[model samples]
Target: EDCPHREKNGWMGDAHLAAEMAFYNYDVAHGYTKWLADIADEQRPSGEVPGIVPTAGWGYFFGNGPAWDCSLFLIPWYTYLYTGDVSIIEKQYPSIRRYIDFLATKANEHHIVAWGLGDWCPAKTETPAEITSTAYYFKGAEILSKMATLLGDSGSATRYAQLAEDIKASFNRQFYRGNGIYGNGSQTALACALYQGLAGEYLTETVDALVNLVKSNNYHLDCGILGAKYLINALLDNGHADVAYRIVSKRTYPSWGYWVEQGATTLWERWDGENSRNHPFFGDVGAWFYKALGGLRIDEDRPGFKHVNLNPIFPEDLDWVDVHHESRYGNIKSSWKREGKHIHWEVNIPNNTTATVFLPLGRQGEVREGGKAIRQSIARINIIRETDDMKVIYLTSGEYTFTFVNDQD
Candidate 1:
């Protein structure tokens, strides 16, 4: 219902809609991707798509149109992961390339692509000519490069990789703030660049800076909705999962988990850091907590790809943490027990590829997929040489049986 003017309002602008679909509540996210496909089809000669589609009576807030900024870079990646449709990728490549071309033209003399801060952090008064803008260009280049590799554009992949490298060099030279923080932009964006590998050698230092910044600034990064989602992910990916978890669990008036604790089904625009009653946006809330904090990661590299990494860290004292995810591959029903000694996971692999299960030490396991028995064994942990000589199983992605124990019989 977010993009109601398009005649098909069921799936439009429902970012958290994916979590619902994952939980088997409904397939609203799927429908939303369909709408994205429709919008992708209508790109101009420049291949740019509007960020928002206007609906009658929806007004400017609802009809913000497409963004010619970094947000545009996320479309192709999001599309592929949610739907696992490669044909769409091929169809959208030209438009994506046009976007790349636009960036190439915007590159500074140092070949760094600089963009004005758009739709990310507020109070980020720095103009387009600032470091955040260039960082945006760098981040976009990295994404486009990956999309190209996935689409079989080896030539373009190489080109974009080179461009990304150049941007990294430029970012460090121009944005690196010698005190372990990247000074080119806001702390959140800098953390993202590092976590996503866009920051190259600057990764560790940037993360250190972000950690300190959050702590010193009282965990308030002056971020908006768009920026908060990214900041959290960056923290998780860079091995600061604990720090990231704190933001979600911080009970201060505006922390992420604070809203959920307040009985909110969705997230607000700003946190209590900025204001206690500042709830401007409705669509932004539930989405981030479900995807990021929930640690719901779907590996889109393999379509109908049922491989998911379930690493959930529930806040202290929470009885149990659960997340339901939907993939073009199959359904993921998973939960975590913080107090449990061993990790437990159960999923239905999409019908087709065989699943290779990795068991934790001290936990012996047996699995049967499609009614066939699977054998298990042990291997050295953190060892240099590994052998698959331990165990093997064949599963056709549908329904299967999984049983494991802390002691081998």
Candidate 2:
């Protein structure tokens, strides 16, 4: 439902984001595949994808933007990523290309496509609509290029790659101002720039400004629909996981916990209970829990469960985290706990699958697997690399319990 008091339709933006979690949490391939077909059937003759599938035909006349139109590219791309199914791309390729072409028609002389919803609902923001739309435009091109390459369409792949680079150059030249400043210092603008790699040489300054913006807001998120999905990951990538956790754990106004505190059993359409009480668009934080905190990642190169990435980040505030994802291959589990000065991490990789585990030891040298020391002579376990704080190990399918002392103390 858009709102309990308003229309209840399957909006593209909500479904696109919600689909991310569904693909991870449950077996949604069958239903999601059908939905993708339905969305394709609903496409207009002009190649405009509606904002809401099975609509009364309102969004097509208006309201559709890069953020909304991107569902076409995103759903199939994400499906391929999770299931390793190329047929979805094969079926949707033509429509996806047509839609991007439609978007190209909307671009101004500078290749800046700026006509869509920008950060739909934040209490306050300084990011502009042009920035959000153009950034997403760039993202769509980037994903389409990948999809083209995967489908063996070399010409389309090269074309989309060039298109993506052009969009990025245009976006940076128009929006970025050398330092952490982007179109009036809006959190959404800076976060989008950082998330999309549009900041270029200004990445460091942009990240610092983003952290300061979050800190200034008392560790609360100040983004809307467009920026919310990328903000947490951007923070995590830039060595700000602590800040991400703090924002997630925040229980005050305008936060996820705040909604839960207000008796929300499901995600709300807005930060405040001003509209629909049941919405999944803003509930992307659930994916962050499993991906960032639990550290269960599906390798893009090895899409599906063929190769799993276990890089759980143990926040100093949390004692332990347990996460299990049932991939197309099988069930993958990652659980870690701190007992005194030792960190015990246990992982379960499904049969016929391999995993790369990154265990945090914090400079402690003693590491063991199944009560046996992990050394260069180990047959099944390969110590890929050892940094100052973590050990990276490559392993085949099996249940393994690794123990190491956290030398931080």
Candidate 3:
């Protein structure tokens, strides 16, 4: 269910679509724990989770698909990632394994999942469930493989990892068209492939195609709740964060800014705002804001924000940004502003946490911290890498302010 005006059910698609934003904005993992228990306790004998939790024997046959069911696999993994506790994975291990087994039985010879809704309410284009669902099938198996590895079950890990690769092969055989297109040349399919790491070798080509696709649409988002986050990631991960910003900053049709301009204070059920006035399905943009603009990000290898990657990408037109988050470790802050040819950056890394901070600078520049030379700033800051336009440094928990004088750019 999307809103109280509608079914008000616990829709898995809505849950997982906003999972990232939820994790970053609030301490929702504890609350999600009991809900995850409900989801597992309500798992069907056939190993499929219903579209709605605590259902009355509905949503299993038609309302739910792999995309919706992915919350079972994806959310637990995210829980473990955000909390660094294996208990969540352990609690759902059996159900996860059984669900993947059931999915394996459902796949056709070509390993395509054509069941359930596909790309709910995409703007102006159709993406098949066969493509989207199977893509999620690959993701579920891939995540299971990693979870198995974390649990010290080598056999299951190898089995699921290999199964994921086989599913990938099947997906490419059926859906991948030449030159980085997935299915029907839709943004949904392309963005899914890029987000799930399905575009293994043609990653750059796929990113270029997505960029071209956005350009063709005049920098407006056409994806639904599902593809929006991944589309943002595909661009940000491939060095086109500016393009992602351009898409989200639009205030015309099919853009969130358009909704804001219309005197709306709540998220709409659709881009056109034709139905419900409050919805959380399209909240992934909040996560993008923290990651891309605020320079706050988490690492899989170092879960629970023990260590972080501060890789802020500057928007082409926006000259100032301020971001802060209270992660499990402590408060993390990053703020930057451009003044003429100079940049004033301030950051706060809480105690007992370390951060890898990246500074966007030109080849020739002078950097000073606390009004002192960066070289004399401390025994804490160490330059790891420097290049023509950027510098990378390692920082232990502390508050810092750095000023960069633009000499080359």
Candidate 4:
């Protein structure tokens, strides 16, 4: 259902675009697991999924494209990622393989999938459906490869990895127009490519293009639901979170802040606040608050809250963020405040769990925990890795407080 009133349907695109947000904030394993079975039951024998589940034989040939169809793969995958439940993946394996085969049937000779309702409801349509569709195909294949490895099917894993590589090559060849332009170089185009791992060697340029696009828009969002999911993370993941922070903080038209100015009680169906003013299509932005702003993250190698990753993006002007999630293991929390070149961070990891805490506090020697140097703070915390901008420390379940001061951090 998209809105509280009017035309609430089992739209597949809505499910996936918001899937990550849902999984991050709530415990939805059982519900999504059963839904996966029901949705797979609706899968056509031709390996195609209807755009809507529980359909009365419609949506087979209409509104069914890579973006909508990719939901079938992502829903279960997110379930596994958040819950560490392999049973759902096992249950949906056959259906998953069939869906991948269906995508193959749709791909062109160059391996690009050009069909789909792409970047649905764009603020200013720019990315070609083909670009997002093809990238999603690659993402689906890559996830499937990881699934195969988890299922002890090394052969399939290698096969799908190869397929994903082929799709990536094709996507880059067809869409990477050089100089960071992808299919007219809309914010959605650069963002989708950057977030989907399709940017390859041109990642830096792609981020620059996305940043420039947002700047050109006066820090307003030019993407709608589909591109909206990837846009923030793409910028944040590429070390340009300062730019991302500016975009989201804008209180102008076509931005979330404008919705606030409009006294929006909920997100609107469209950026301009037309149609249903309360809609879920663009609600995935909530996920960023928890993951990027709060810095609570997941480790693919240790799915669920079995292992946590804390990588906060401290906005330049924002004061602080406090976020916590009750994982299957226990409560996982991260809170941080910046004070004039100094930072105070507090983290709580649940019993029987561990975390890789990323502290972006300049050089390794400058960061301290409990009033001691990082290296001296352990028996519980260990400095596992360090880079120019961040010190990655591993710690066991417990409450920990860290402080660091560096103007350049």
List lDDT for all candidates, in order. Answer: 0.51, 0.83, 0.85, 0.85
Per-residue CA lDDT of candidate 2, range 1-409, in tens?
2545567777788777677788878887777778788888988767778888777777886667888778788888888888888888889888888888888988998889878766787756646788988987898889989998988999999999999999998888898776687776777888888888788788899999989989999998888876788788788778887788898899998799999899889888778877777778887788889888888877999998789888877776678888898887788998889897787888899899999988777555778888888884347688899887778989998888888886655
Q: Each prediction's TM-score against the native?
A: 0.70, 0.95, 0.96, 0.95
In model 4, which runs have C-alpha deviations exceeding 4 angstroms?
338-341, 362-365, 386-388
Q: How far is 197's C-alpha from truth in model 1 (Å)?
A: 2.4
RMSD of each: 6.6, 1.8, 1.5, 1.9
lDDT of 3 at 123: 67
Candidate 2 clashes between residue pairs 3 or more apart in a chain or in different chains: 3-276, 4-276
lDDT of 4 by residue, 147-263 (tens): 898899999999999999999999989888888888877888889889999888998887888888788888888997888888988887888877777877889877888999989
The best-first sequence of candidates by lDDT reads 3, 4, 2, 1
Best by lDDT: 3
lDDT string, candidate 3, 116-159, tens digits: 67788776777888888899899999999999999999999999
Give me the displacement of residue 165 in model 3, in angstroms. 0.9
Better of 1 and 4 by lDDT: 4
